[model samples]
Each structure stands twice: as structure tokens, then as C-alpha cells.
Target: MKKTSKKNNNFKIPGTELNSSDAERGKKESQSNFVELLPLEVTSKIFSQLDIQSLCRASRTCTSWNHAIRNNDSLWKSHCLTIRAVCQREIDDDVKSGYTWRVILLRNYQKSKVKYEWLSGRYSNIRSPVSLPEKAMCPMDADTWGEILDAELEREVEKLQ
Candidate 1:
């Protein structure tokens, strides 16, 4: 087997933290208290500016950040209500058109004689009184939909960050 070459030291990728000096800075950035630097007002603005998806994404970055975001029920509730509003449109349309149309429009969501479900979490079945779409979108049980939303929201927020 060919042995690894060391241009400087530490055997790290060349030009990328190959030496102790570079590694120290890399560690410093991760350790930096960037979160603490932002004041509460600024943080609240940033938080408010963030839609539900952004807040969820921020929660996945690390333990401290996740806990902070999760604790903010207002943010989560806002997200839930927003999703509910969007999906409620479908239900309203379904009602005007008829139950038969509900089946066709929500074909992605299969239905049994018992009930209807959306196989696609991105889409939702409108439940009357209009519950949150977090449950509606899943083609499967809400257990799966919850996971899907959690993952999707985190991804969206990370991309923005």
C-alpha cells in the first residue's frame, strides 16, 4: 500500500487544515459564541423573520439551538396554523365539488371505506374543523408525517442559513 504524504503535517487534506494552525482556527469557528452574540431583540426579529420551516431547520443544527427553537411553541404553532390554512383550501374546494372530487383531487392520498389519507406529506387530506396539515399530508400514519415534516423543515432552514 502507498503511504500517505504529508505536505506540512497532521496528514490532513492539503491546503485545508493540514497543519495545527489551520486546525486551531477551524475549531475556533465551531466554538465561537455566535449565538450568544445576538441580543434577544435581534434574535426575536431573526426568529420572527424566520417562517416555521426556518425555525425548525435552526433547531436541528445542535443541541443548544434545537432546544431553544423547540421551546418556542409560538413559532411551532405559527407554522402549524400556516400549513393548516394552505391545506384548508383543498378541503374547501373538495366540499364545494363533492366527496367524489375529494377522492380524485387527493388521489395521492388513498381512502378506505373507513377514511382518507394523503400518501404525500406535501399534500394533505382536509379533515373537517380543518385540523393541522401536519397530520393530513402523510400518505401513512401521522407518526410518519411528523417525521417527514421535522426532516423537511430542518432541511429548508439549513439551506437558508
Candidate 2:
């Protein structure tokens, strides 16, 4: 058997060495934005499928993703409508006031959660603030409080009868 030369001792397995061509290709792949590869309509449709939490998490992953998510108001609109089921007046007011879907959602998300709990009687039996769920309270407008109060009264009436 022929012996290998010392000069050839630095043998790298084929394709193991990252040559200029490989480096350039890898760089191109990394630099290519997934959002840019697709048409905005397609990207919006794809992102529209993501849930609110998933959309939010994906937005934080990269600037491109964030831009793609932020530029599509329809994506936010669907989630806002889901919240509107719980806070109808609040959402309607915001929409009528010319607020963007994203802004409307951000403004009402926490309020909706707290309001839903109250309206659903989740907190109907609480005797004091100490008995409330931790982090369950949010500042809501008078209309929202009125709705909650009305719900509580209805619950009381149901109990009385």
C-alpha cells in the first residue's frame, strides 16, 4: 500500500470543509427572509392562521416576522373580534373611534379577561379583594363595570328566585 504524504496529512473529509462557495451559500440562505420569499397576501394568510399568543411570540422572533405580523391588520382583527365577544361595547367603541385593530386588541385584552371573569360569575362569591384571583383585575371603563354589576345583580336575582 502506498503511504500518504505528510503534505496531504491535513485531509478534510469531502464537503466537511466550509469553502468559499459553501460559506457564500450558507450566508445567502441565512440572509434570505422567509417573509420576503412569499407574497404579502400569502404571508398574511399564513400568519392569520396563528393564534394571538403564537402570533405575538412569532413577532418577537425576528424583525422580519414582527414587520410581517404588524403590517397585517386582519391578523389582529380576528383576535380582536374574539375578544369582542366578551367586551362588545369596548371593542365597538374602539373600532368606531378609528383605532387600529392591533391597538384595539392591546387596549382591551387584559380588560376583557378580567371583565369576562366577573361577568361569568367567576368572582361572584368573593368576599373581599383578598379572595380575588391574583392578577385578575384590570382597569375597565365605567360601561364595563356597569355590565359586570348588571351581571352580578342578575346572578343574585337567580339565587333569590
Candidate 3:
């Protein structure tokens, strides 16, 4: 007796079964590999999995992704502020509560008041005591950065001593 060819059977795709109601749902589900295609929330979860360097590099990959990461200013504001430690200083109380960063930037960089106002006012919410270097300020190199860290550590150790 000859066996029938399996291809002759009008059969359901073994793993492609759809319990979805609408054709659109079925089509979307079938075309989208649930295993591969993440939902937006899941995509964000995957993004958060990346290290800081990976995240920054990924942002430059394309326009849409870049927009997403860059627009999330609040997420990186703290990091930017902390790394900007050397630029920090306390402003005169008489000037204003949160003008420290601007004041330090202008003073350390010797920027004009007009340019200072232009640059500082661009940030939506800035530091109270000022953080982050001004545009004119030359960024500290790794050696200088290390020295600053060492000085800070020495001060901290001395305080505990």
C-alpha cells in the first residue's frame, strides 16, 4: 500500500495556529515573531538592559531611537550633573537660589553675561549650586579628572580622620 504525501493534506500550520478573533490580529501576530519583535514597553526594557556606553552608541544609530533617548533628559540629567562636579560652585545668595552653575560657568570661563544667559537658560531645570561645565569652559582631561577625584577623596578621608 502507498502512503499519501503529507503535502496533499489541507492542514493547519502546526505552530501557526491563531486563536485571535480578527484577521488583522491574526495577520499581525503571524507576521510578527513574538519571540523577536518586542512591544514598545518591552523594547524599553531591552534598552534599559544596555550599559551606558551601549545606550549612548545606540542613540546615534538612527533618528527615531536618538529622539527617544535624547528626549529623556531627566534620565541622564543626574549623571551629567555628577560628572560636572568640577564646574560647580555656590552662587551669591543675593543673586538667586539656583544660579550657581551659571555663575560658576561664567566666572570660570569668563563668558559675557549675554552669552551666559543664552547658554544657561537653555536647560529646562538646572542645578541649584550649579553643575556641568559651560560651553566656553575647557573640559578637564583624564589626568585632571583623576586629580580632582584624588583631592576630593583626600578631603573626605581627612574629614573622617
Q: What are the runs in model 3 whose C-alpha is more than 4 Å off? A: 1-14, 17-40, 74-161
Could you arrange the candidates by lDDT from highest to lowest?
A: 2, 1, 3
- Which regions of candidate 2 are displaced past 4 Å? 1-27
Candidate 1 residues lying further than 4 Å off, grouped into runs, are 1-31, 86-161
lDDT (0 to 1) per candidate: 0.48, 0.85, 0.46
Clashing pairs in 3: 101-130
Tens digit per residue, CA lDDT, model 2, 1-161: 64433332232457687665555555665688769777898889889889989999999989999988987889999999999999899999999999999999999999989988888888999878788777778777888889988998999999999
Best by TM-score: 2
Candidate 3's residue-wise lDDT over 1-161, tens digit each?
64433332232466775442333444545765332455556655656566556767877877767766555544344433433443333223212455344233333333222223323343223344265445544443454445545655665576798
Q: What is the RMSD of candidate 3?
A: 15.0
In terms of lDDT, the best-performing candidate is 2
How much is 114 displaced in model 2, in angstroms?
1.1
> Candidate 1's residue-wise lDDT over 83-140, tens digit each?
4343444444444665443132333222221122232333333445356444333344
Question: Whole-model lDDT, candidate 3?
Answer: 0.46
